[model samples]
Target: MSTITHRLPQKRHLVTELPGPKSVALAERRQAAVPAGLGSGVPVYAVDGDGGVLVDVDGNSLIDLGSGIAVTTVGASNAAVADAVAAQAHHLIHTCFLVTPYEGYVAVAEKLNELTPGDHEKRTALFNSGAEAVENAVKVARVATGRDAVVAFDHAYHGRTNLTMALTAKSVPYKHNFGPFAPEVYRMPMSYPYRDPLGDDGVAAARRAITAIGTQIGADGVAAVIVEPIQGEGGFVVPAPGFLPTLAQWCRANGIVFVADEVQSGFCRTGDWFACEHEGVVPDIVTTAKGIAGGMPLAGVTGRAELMDAVHPGGLGGTYSGNPVACAAALAAIDQMETLDLCARARAIGEIATSSLTATAALLAADGREVIGDIRGRGGMIAVELVRPGTSEPAPDLAKAVAAGALARGLVILTCGTYGNVIRLLPPLVIDDALLREGLAILGEVLAESA
Candidate 1:
């Protein structure tokens, strides 16, 4: 087996407090210069990172299970990506794809087209972020279908931009007071197996969503139906088995473009190239980012060639849409994912994490303290939902404590869910076995402490 080699030793070592003197000083400076709207998970500054550890400004080596919110799938500080970035930077910084075309952009587009779940002739448009990719996908759908109404799902998180904010479900931080959002976006029910009134019957859950779309919006009036194959920030809510296929078939029958928002679930993060392939359902359009460029800013919208090319010349692209450096990083990251076979790595990590979490849950239940409502997710993207003992009521407070406690103990984690009760674990795919187990053990310890 070809094991991935790390540049930095994979271990956690906290020298000073989490927000040490230097970080605290930087925080004070940030308070004056930066916007208060930006929230920090640990309030520490990072100077270096590799494998699964992020070295803070205070010299605290913390095990990184968040992966910069799943952006650094190859590794936090990938040498291949850095080399590609530097080589490209040494040539030209930006010529703007609109002004002068570059092969790096075309190469990335070709890679996305070849990898994005279908053999059909495909076209791609690159963007600077996930939100832009999603927005452009919607635009392509509307233009192709000649319809204005787009349907999004409950518990879905598309992005933070105006159109995507309309697609997102949560309000407090992502969408609160940030609208008059874009018009014509409708919310439908998602096949959230945990909380669905249909009781894990995915066919019925999908039927309800399809019925709502047909009755409320009229199938012919809808331009697109967008959903995350596995909801990320809305909680790692893996839909029941039959939900996605049913929706895809229904969209095909209705001529509505079916979009898979794979921003958080793509590039071998979920033990697959794309999460939609787990069910063998191919989307008409796909939005990808997060794990694409190994921490560089890049996103893509890939779809059927006819639909993407329907837009006239000069209809798509931005100044930095496919910056040379970003494209180079993306190519290198894709190579790393392939050479390392991170898909298999993700599945192996999933088994290890699931076993540890399941054991912890059983131990808690043995003590009559069943605070974990559920432990679910695939591959490297896993989560545990905290709930009041013996009840389904969300325990956001408990989740918050678990996160804070983990950070203090030198393990970095994150929380999500509409109710804010999910602790998501997203370790880098190249994490060493011992390091991964050690990090998960810290998580188990934190949960036990909460119990």
Candidate 2:
């Protein structure tokens, strides 16, 4: 079971100094070809990836703990997904779902509607990216409710589009000089236990966000309340227990369409098929992407039938939305997930991560190094929040150094959060146990050395 299918060895091997001569030359080419705004986390260029390792251009096999920012949850080269993609590509790639609707797109929508929370009659619209899904979700909400105001929580990351930028709270990187963003998007206090004064009391924190919504945005005017089931990019912040439920209930009572942005925390990345299930919150609209199509560019907006049907006949859809090839890949990915029981695998991975990180933090503390401010998340999506030693102050610099150190050791890790102080572990669910631990050990050593 520990030996996940892959052509390359599952061990971390560094043959060259990070960006070897070949990678250095490619970097020079990339600097000239690619825009500076687009950044890469790992220094080396990837040639192939499967199972738990990424083979770089310089013959270095780096352990991939980021899963390409949580997109390749089924691994980079699942045989089934590849075969499906190839079969579909051989037949028909795209005919424009709108012009000549295909069964693949309809089949994917049917699957999404069936899988998302709640057994009630649901519908789904496919799109190209998470931002596009989010934007359309809001569009559906506003059209159905006839309201313009929308409420988003703090530390929320819907996407990078103009509307999503307004929905986001962080500024420097995501929102810097990108205004004037879409108007009528209100930010509410999220149930952030680590940073909130309320501590672990999720009920009270929900109350705070609800009150702010009523006073600041006028709940009556709100078309939707969009939030990440487990905030990704915004530090992997999991709202305290009872927090999401309270907000969902409030939205229900106020006639607001509760939109759960599960773009990053969906598709078994958080143990459950969807992170909102952790809190038993059935959102009115669920935005999905990232791990949806086995790295294929596909997004979905699943919601109540009435809300989705409210839009005009041609209101939703794009030229490449739900491309046949992507749908085929999604189908095979779903088959692999169900047959392999990836949800259970994710839970097992979560267990290992929580135990290892907690033990490592305790050991570090015993040595008088207390940089780990918090450790949180479920399933394979774990986060280690770094803080100043002996204090709760955020330490972004320390987080950067730790990630860089791990990269030097041939482990590809990712750091995220509004303050950029959280190291998030998003290994593919198919990662072998030994490889996952080896990656964890490298991260632990890097953090310890950073102290």
Candidate 3:
């Protein structure tokens, strides 16, 4: 049996400055070859990653707090993940599960069905990315309900694809100039407690949203009401405790499918197998992606069997839908999550990190400069919204400065929100407590300086 250890790998030497000579050289090459706007958020070059540390090509050993946008839940360059991928590659790379079904693919689906919330007989379909999973869920809902209208929430982010762009709420980068998008897609107000019309009353806000759906769109014409259980890109916004359950009840009563977009908040990222699980709400359809395959490109949509089977025999599949390598990696990732008790770790990390951020933000606020407006999220998926004093306005400049400051201190932090004023932390669930504390200390220092 392989021994399981909780210690993170030691950080090596940081010879040159951040994005040192080697990374600078690679960035230059990438700028010439890659598209102009392709690589902006993260540094261009990576030399190695193991456990919680990312070793850049410049030889800078930085604590990986971003986790590749929350995809590497089990940790970057995990031994089990590497071994599984290598062994599967040796055996068979791509058999195209659609053409010739493979055990690895079927096993992955079974695991997803078993793991995802909802005890009712569930069926799962695998896809290549979170975007594909969402697209498939939309397709299944449209076909199953025989309705054309799909309703998404404001400030929601589904994906970058054409159909998903219509579902997504952001327009500047995701939807700007990419329009002539899919039709019959509508947007509705989400129960944003921080900025809710009902003053943080989640239940009342949900009822208001439901009422709008009934009056404006007519629930009969709506195929599905899709939402992220805990908004990922909309700044780790966790809806009121009773908000999602109320919506799910409404969807069931009206026969409109409820799809939970768990792409960024699923697979133990939010302390449970799915964020929806926190509310005891079982969606008709759940889309999962990030953190599903230990960084491999794999996604899945699990839903009621009847809804999933609504598509005709040949309606739901892709050429590389369930690639064997990704399947094997997913199976191994699931094992790692279960064996390592990552869900509990996610909760623990969230408690520690969020508490630290909240305390630091309060201190800054007491100093007459409001540093954080809201600190909200469930489990490990947490965010701190930065704002100016005496108003709810976004502090984008401060957020940028804090992120850059953290990066300079050898820590990788990611910022997100509709206004880009929220500093989000998505460190791997397996991050050691010591490293986590160190990262939080760096963030506190940045906050103090920015204030």
Candidate 4:
């Protein structure tokens, strides 16, 4: 395999204590200026990033495993993306696709329609964020199907918008005090292979969800069933093998639009273009963000042409929807993905991560420190669920400790899940294998130390 290095060198170098003096000083200003609600995972402030390393103001070069929540799949400082964005800025930054109708916007839409699963006449609309894409997808589904209710699964995270907040499963930070959310939204059981009470029978799990939807909200009343093939934020939960296909099939039979929120798992973050592709489950609408524009704020909802056209022209648009510069970045990022064959790279990254994490779990088990309850995911979008030793109970404390430990050692990592017990690893797809392994080694060592 060829090594794809970014602008920054592929190595970890910590100059001082984490949140060194400069970072600490900046923190004081941030507390006074930035709102408390805007929380950061790591305290340090990044001045530059490239390849798999984020160089902070403190001069600490931390190995990036989070990828800015899986955004920079082409690397944070990708040359192609930078060049395109710069050129676009020099030409025209924002013409507003809704008004001026730029070619860059149309180009991105065409790409999304062509790239997303299924060739059955797809249409795409670009947005500023995942939440907007999801909201628009729901709108299209409701208008197309003429149904009022939408179904979202357990542990699913759509976004922070008011409508998406209602669709989200967790409450604490995302939905707390954000009451009176959009109504007519219903929740159903997810096929959580590790934690499901019904075990890992994919078809049976699908049946359970279908039955719940029927009892709670009839099929005729439901417009869409939105799901994340690999649940993000709720934990990197990969459902049993056949769970997604069955649910999608049922949605089709019921005339409900199946929307796959691939915000975190789309692009080459997963081995496939989208996680739904792994199960051969083609969603009526697929929401994409994060990795779409190589750090530029861009998201897209690609769906069936008929459904997309069902909505009136002015019904779906935002002032900044499909910004020209972001579109240019996206086009360049897509080019990089194709030229480098990032899909194959993602699969290789997954293989390495799964093997390394599995070995770490086994070692911990042999030592009677079974904190790693599960290690699951596809491609670079992998996570390790921490639990109490020899038991299924969540070990959130251990998970936090592991993340902190890794961060302190100049290895950037992120933790997520409803229970806050999952440590998710999302290194850049173009990251060098040696650096990737180095970060994983640090994570494994941290886990061992915690045990």
Candidate 5:
């Protein structure tokens, strides 16, 4: 086993239960003051974090399997990230990249161009969040191609904004009441082999989607086809091996831009700099946010120079775009990723998670119960879907139980997927193996008991 030092000094220690009196009190206050809607996916209240451990308000130390929804890849409270942020804050925080451009911003963009999967001359625009990046990708595509229609896949989870929501597939939470969305945004079937259309190869599924675009919006009128190489919230659905390449080829032939939303899978979370590399697919545009800055709020769209330059000088920037602090943190984060070999660590984490979850799944099957229907993912970004016996029906109840059970035993896990039946793990790549194994052992225990 290998050992790594945590970045932050340990302070608050677990004294009470998972959510002690302090956390309960804070929750009550939050409920009274904050809106009913904006709490959190996981019930735990974070006070601080270091390495792969989250320190809760109640003083409970939890082994974090969810890296702040995959936003902190280097580690929570990374030393390089903190030092860079502090140094930049003392000098300058924000001048608005549009008003007074900064060197850090340009440096970060250069790093992105060098790192993201592409050999062509590329450019980048920084933003504040994943949703903003996705929205800007559409804008750039439209400006460069002079088209209005944007195509996305079924079971896709782009973002929560009007345009991105329309591009998103699920209705219950993301799109149910958010109607009258942006126009000309179309949805097509994604290549989900677990629940793929009958007699359809993944390539065929992509072609079917392209055919729908031709019939509905006409290829001449389409601006871009956006996809997640591995569907994040829709489930950790890894499309067939050739699916993305085939789609990219079609887009090239049609002169339609291909955008890869690597927001959740980028920054070494999936054992690679970007998920599209797994398929050798080079997207015309790539959007990345989570994990890019070691938890700082930063997102970017990197693409061909001509398409990016198509936007007018004042057309693509915001008041806070390319914030200096975020840019500095991002530079440090990228350095950490490289120096620590976090990509390889991500692959090791995935192997450990898959082995543990698959073993638990087998035990459940022997007992005539099904706790995990599938354990699938790449690198450190892994997921386990809970299902009812002999059926593919989503088992959200079981998922909730397992998560709560893990929490009670001092492990922090997160659940996602359209049905909320999938348990996704995005632990920091710098986590200690002993701690990682401890968390996985707890998860196995929870699954066995739940079954």
Candidate 6:
């Protein structure tokens, strides 16, 4: 019922400028220690986080609208998760689930099996990151189907691993100079409602992709069709209604595994346990992370038992897979999510964000600014796609400025998309309504000023 935990004030307060003296010093230390490849969206250094605010090293409390990139949905300081992690660390941190199979790991698998879409008998394997989960999911599909080729959609972002890089559509930062990527990966069109070449017919979009896969990669040779139920890095594009269903149906009909990369859209962040539930389209495999362990490093691939079990026992585990402490955190996080009914909370957040963003878009349009070309997403995962003043051309610079402005005003936001023109809002599910409203209001003000 509270926004801030640890007795930290819930309200966003700026005691000093962002990246103040202490934070600037820490940034210098970070630059000396951390690799340049790892980029930080916000320059400030955080020392504490609770509820919806991140308290920086300089004592500036910034409202968290990004949820640590959607990984802290239960808030950054959930008592349940913190207690479980501490208790588990005291008992046993790691025996590598593969080496000494812990009950916590099994319990997490059970939870994922029950919560993910569909009633079919399911099994789950834990991994260390979303990229690992995706790689494992593809391994399961490939082994199950005995096919080598996989199909991914445009604007899709799977991961940074070589296989995932091949699966990803964007090349500049994600895939550039990372090749030669995994071979036999095919790219197909997604059912992007905003950029649909064939109007907004989900069925037609599916047909287009299906036909292309068959013609280009031969559907028979394709092992899986992997996609984000609602494209995440691809501008939070909520595909046209029926789009996922049609794709799922096609995959089933063609013996191709339909894998939903719910890494960013899962775990009640999308109003449901999984985004696939919105369209009632059950994926053959679902890869999840980022919020699965309440900010802990954990990921999972849950899917039908037949396909999951198809992988040879030794073929599936990593040294750190399902670290006992992370397993404990996941279990506790899951408990908190269900008890708090974060699904409904996400829905409520979605309503607020979408309404506010849509209203802002309307206002901008009325003023002929037209910076916000589209607003879409589900549950707590929402985004505003910025475009040029009068055209649909992406305005990535404007998006950057708006995020910078919000940051300067003690608000933390994240921007992502293939073209980098999307301002995504993924607040913690447990955030207080008042704080959430304040953050959104700041976003509106920033947009208005930027326009």
Against the true structure, what is each candidate's TM-score? 0.99, 0.99, 0.97, 0.99, 0.97, 0.98
Error of 6 at 242 (Å): 1.5
Pairs that clash in candidate 4: none
Q: Which stretches in model 5 have alpha-carbon errors above 4 Å?
A: 1-3, 7-14, 198-200
Please report the TM-score between candidate 1 and the true structure.
0.99
Q: Can you rank all candidates by TM-score, best first?
A: 1, 4, 2, 6, 3, 5
What CA RMSD would candidate 1 show?
A: 0.8
Tens-digit lDDT string for candidate 6 (1-451): 2223444678989999887899899888988999998989999988888888899988899999999989999989888899999999999988977677879999999999999989999999999999999999999999999999999999999999999999999998888887899999999988888877875798888888888988898878989999999888878988888778988998999899999999999999999999989989899999999999999999999999999999877999999999999999999999889888999999999999989888888888898888998888899999998999988899999999999999999999999998899999999898888899999999999999998
User: For candidate 3, lDDT tens digit of each residue in 1-85?
Assistant: 1235634465534567666777778888887899986747766377777767888867678888899989999878777888999
Model 2: runs farther than 4 Å from truth? 1-4
Q: For each candidate in the order shown, give its overall lDDT on alpha carbons.
A: 0.93, 0.92, 0.87, 0.93, 0.88, 0.91
- Tell me the TM-score of model 3: 0.97
Model 3 has an lDDT value of: 0.87
Error of 2 at 278 (Å): 1.2
lDDT-wise, the better of 5 and 6 is 6
**Candidate 4 TM-score over all chains jointly:** 0.99
Q: Give RMSD to native, each candidate.
A: 0.8, 1.1, 1.7, 0.9, 1.8, 1.4
Which is the leading candidate under lDDT?
1
Error of 6 at 298 (Å): 0.7
Cα lDDT tens digits for candidate 1, 1-451: 1476788878999999877899999999999999999998777899999989999999999999999999999888899999999999999888999999989999999999999998999999999999999999999999999999999999999999999999999998999988899999999999888888876788888999999998889999999999999999999999999999999999999899999999999999999999999999999999999999999999999999999998879989999998999999999999999999999999999999999999999999999899999999999999999999989899999999999899899999999999999999999998888999999999999999986
Candidate with more favorable, higher TM-score: 2 or 5: 2
**lDDT score for residue 87 of model 1:** 95
